[model samples]
Target: MAHRRPATGRVSTLSEAKASSRAARSRQLCRSRRKAVSCSGAAARQSCSRATWTWSDYALEEAGRLTHPLRYDAETDHFVPIAWDEAFERAGAALRSVADPNQVEFYTSGRASNEAAFLYQLFAREFGTNNFPDCSNMCHEATSVGLPKSIGVGKGTVTLEDFDETDAVFSFGHNPGTNHPRMLGTLREVSRRGKPIIAINPLRERGLERFQDPQAPVEMVTLGATPISSAYHLIKVGGDLALLKGMMKALFEADALDMAAGGAGLLDREFIHMHTSGIDALRADIDATDWDAICRVSGLSRDAIESIARGYWTAPRAIFCYGMGITQHRHGTETVQQMANLLLLRGNFGREGAGICPVRGHSNVQGDRTVGITEIPTEHFLERLDRAFGITSPRAHGHNAVEAIAAMRDGTAKAFIGLGGNLAVAISDPQTTFPAFRKLDLSVQIVTKLNRTCLLTARESLVLPCLGRTEIDVQASGRQAVTVEDSMSVVHASRGMLKPVSDTLRSEPAIVAGLARAAVPNSVVAWDELVADYDRIRDKIEEVFPDFYDFNERVRVKGGFRLRVGASQRQWDTPDGLAHFLVTELPLDVEREGHPYLLTTIRSHDQYNTTIYGLNDRYRGITGRRDVVFLNADDLRELGLEHGDRVDIVAGERELRGQTAVAHDIARGSIAAYYPEANGLIALDEHDHASGTPSYKSTPVRVRRAA
Candidate 1:
């Protein structure tokens, strides 16, 4: 798995003269990309993983940073600066007061580094609980749960290098320009070479239409934007499962016709016979599926679905890329499983140009989980962790975000500790989530900036300032480097060039060690020793998770290293040592309940998660506004509403009132609103049953004209 990186995540074989220019530009693009589009701080750790470099909307994240520890004073209704010693003591007391370790909910964000996440989990498990709820659970949990069930691994099979060999790229439910602009360089190359880049999403995003490469000087001087999508098809929100089944059905029907005519079938019979299981069940389901039902649910005609199938069948090697749009639904797990099924039909596994790419948003959300930030730990993992730490860690299943909310609301959980996210606004049903958080005995936020979540006071609340990503961390071992794993499973070192925001600000690892030392004084985990030297922590991680063997040596290498992905070589690690074709029935419909429309949550160009950098959404052409709902122009007139009418976004008993409605190019029954704000109408309990991910992308709602 140890290898040098090229312009992409994989090696490229471009013409000699072009390679030099492309490589230089790629280096420049990734460097500036991080500086321009980063909220997750950039560290000083040396890395050559060009594809992993990310940056976006940086000013708001760095502005008004927290420099000192704060304690909430209820009488004054404000936070006053307190010394770190008192903050740690109060936090230790609060954690100690909880009768059971399970009564504490430990939360982690995607921005947390691998070293810090490892230490955080070790500290929590040492205290006798695995109550770890991470940000991945809110975003890509379906991919984590569903992909492994099919492909034997949860990570993407193809690196950016695969883009070189791919004949086509299929994009689903994602906006590359706003969310992950780094990918645009790869997509731009694909389009310029006359390869098809098919886009399927409910909203007509500007990113999918055309893109101007800031790195391409020729294109820049001409001011010409290259066409990105060969065809942009609008699929109804929450209708992916239905659309996927229909696509499969079209292929299956075509195969039957071809076989009857004494021609070879379209499906890869050899791959099916040699490498996969559960084909009969899948074939039966596709055959039995009614076309009428498919058309009704998918919101696409039979001809439209068949045309997409034609495009897929013609491409010899294609990469399927997706984002939260495919995962944030009630049936999100099944939808992800079907994506694999469609690819398996053409034998796309292990090919250079073809594989499923679950395009993750956060830089190290994947890394956090890799270093054991999961609430549900494998039995083997727990056994090794206990053996390494010399303590009996708890085996009971812990609370996720939903269960954590329920526990806190029912008074079963008493304490909360957040590593880096805005849990208060991040949690849905603010009417309920806000109060449940307030009732907690303790709440601690280890953050770099002051956010709304820090203001959600409990009986004891502390805001502890910590080091951000783009800052130096001079520890006992001198300037230290932390490691992070990108979506492609590339592990790289990251160190910040910027100095500390304040002399008082501590690193997250240091803060966690302080809390651990005070809370569990005699724990054998050796929190202090691990915090002082991150290399020792890496060694410990390598001992526990052998996937990271020789971690310290490999991480320091240029471009870092690639963790072994068995599925990349067609080495299936499933129970029977083969990939699977899982089958799940499509629901009768994505019912709107009492509402006549469906709402999907989105992020603007000027926004990242809960942070709003500015009011304008450049791509959508909205100025000084975040309270606009995007609806189809035809649907707007049908509902007796104009393009700029003020309406109440309602979901039964909940309402986000007086929101300005803006007509746009979305599907007929589908509407779009910015997320973490539209969350008011979404219930905390409403999420995928298996992965526990909120239905952020597909929520049924009604919009009524306001007085």
Candidate 2:
């Protein structure tokens, strides 16, 4: 793909000239590397390093564009091209066949724009069902569930500007280089400015260690990679709860010591007394937690815990940023609360550079929820939506992603309509999930490209290809732009610049409008009119969601506007009108005596969620294969296994056979494997009790040498 950069002048800036030279040298290096490596299959592409063009990237460029809708023929076990009219006719007929609206489930991906998501949930509500199972339920549901109870909001309060003033940044359970590449640039600047960065994860990620931004010519050409993490801790999988508690225990001791010496306490006593509640209970819990148990469970020494506490205690402003590692667990909600608790102890909220940041997985996952794609809708939101659309929205709570899967398995749900996601592959226990798709009466996917989810094939399955993010979307009102909310509370308009890959493909809003018109022929809302102009959709959205009062006008601005974050302004929207601290228990129930190893599923450098861009995990030095399991050298010795040995991973009643094991720098007694492939080992039932988010980060397993 050609990069969109500004034109250089005859006499270029020193930085620009350096960047140009580095870019030229990088291209030369790629050509030389191409001669030495073979980029053929998808697996090979996945294993190829980022500098080299992988087979999958080449395939996408080489293969002609897909320009038609497909219908799955179960009898022939193949996908056959079908006209748009036939595809919609069959999908509409299937929806009509459903005896009750509750039998149909609408699953949405984070990739869907705000315009599309708003229309989708609105249509589902009009159809008289709240069965909105979304992508957030699987990833950051913990943040959504826990942060609201703590800070009165689900989103990260800090913006891109906040990072500039932060004294310290705590990174927990996330890899910035691959998951969010743009973040690496911010981290590079932070490091250069002499701020302390503490990285906490089971594996020592390369991105956290050092970074060389190609966009900066001097850094890339001079090999002057900025060092990131000042302190790195390898906390055990499922040990975040223990680690957090240990840090708090250390902080309490420090506070007491300082107070006895006629000095102010380490904690912000004013913030706790004025803005928060339940500190006594939290203090009692921390006092009761034994240091020996904390060390054993966290896999960190008491001294190390104290050092972590000292860093936070000394920093004027610190930001706690976490990813799926903290959320994809049995006690994901509690873990999130603990992070919030740590931040609140230091008066992090309402500050310019300090806040709890949940690094979201997708670009617009937060936006989807903000625009009302939730199973559990607020009464106020429902009332407003009802008032705006002249229809009574459902009050009863509906199924989340996990519950949706169970609903399908038990035949409670018959029809499934996916709005831009590979639900089957991304979900756990594919052994049962794949068969559940077959049992569905109808399955329809709105996608930009073919994926495994489309091939699962229900009795009547239709694949309606849609316009991608890079393509221009032309509606009845000519060109249109869609809005998306980033991880922070900022909402902005996204206008596609490239031409459409195919004229047959439609925008997400157009397809959703088509389905809505067919599914509810006599609907009170004008579906066609809404799609005609996206501005009208934003107007309706403002009517339903009060936060976006001047949605259309404000969104047209260059940088857009930020939603009202109460916690950011020292205003809490809780029942007591104050932030609250909650006490949490450790996840001792997740421990298994029989299974000595804790397995965490991770994504490769070449992949984004389930989308495979190549075969290489360049940062981790992984190349040419995705079947290797990362293990500690000592653990390998104890298990009587060596590097290159084939092993079978057994978790509960399921087993993944013939995976090669390689010794690495991961925590002892914990193993790491690729996601989706390792997802089969995670049971559908094993999830956080509070959030219903799958425990993908910490699964107890036993490894055996495969014959």
TM-score of each: 0.91, 0.91
> For residues 1-707, could you state the per-residue lDDT of candidate 2 as single tens digits?
21211221111234445644554554554454332222223322321222222223223322233456777655544455678878888988899889989999999999999999999999999998999888998899999999899989988889888899999999989989788778888888888999999998999888998998898899878988889999999988888888899989989999999999999988999989899998999999889989988887778888988898899989999998889999999989999999888889889999888997889978899999999999999999999999999998888899998888888999989999999898988889898788888789999999876566766678898878789877898888999999999988899999999998667888899889888878888899998899999999999999999899899999999999999989999899888998988898765665697898889999989888987665557777665456668888799889877766678899988998877676778988789999878999998898988998989988999998886
Which ranges of candidate 2 are over 4 A from the true structure?
1-65
Q: In order, what is each prediction's RMSD in angstroms?
A: 10.9, 9.0
Candidate 2: global Cα-lDDT? 0.84
Cα misplacement distance, residue 211 of candidate 2 (Å): 0.8
Model 1, position 112: C-alpha lDDT score: 93
lDDT, candidate 2, residue 621?
A: 69
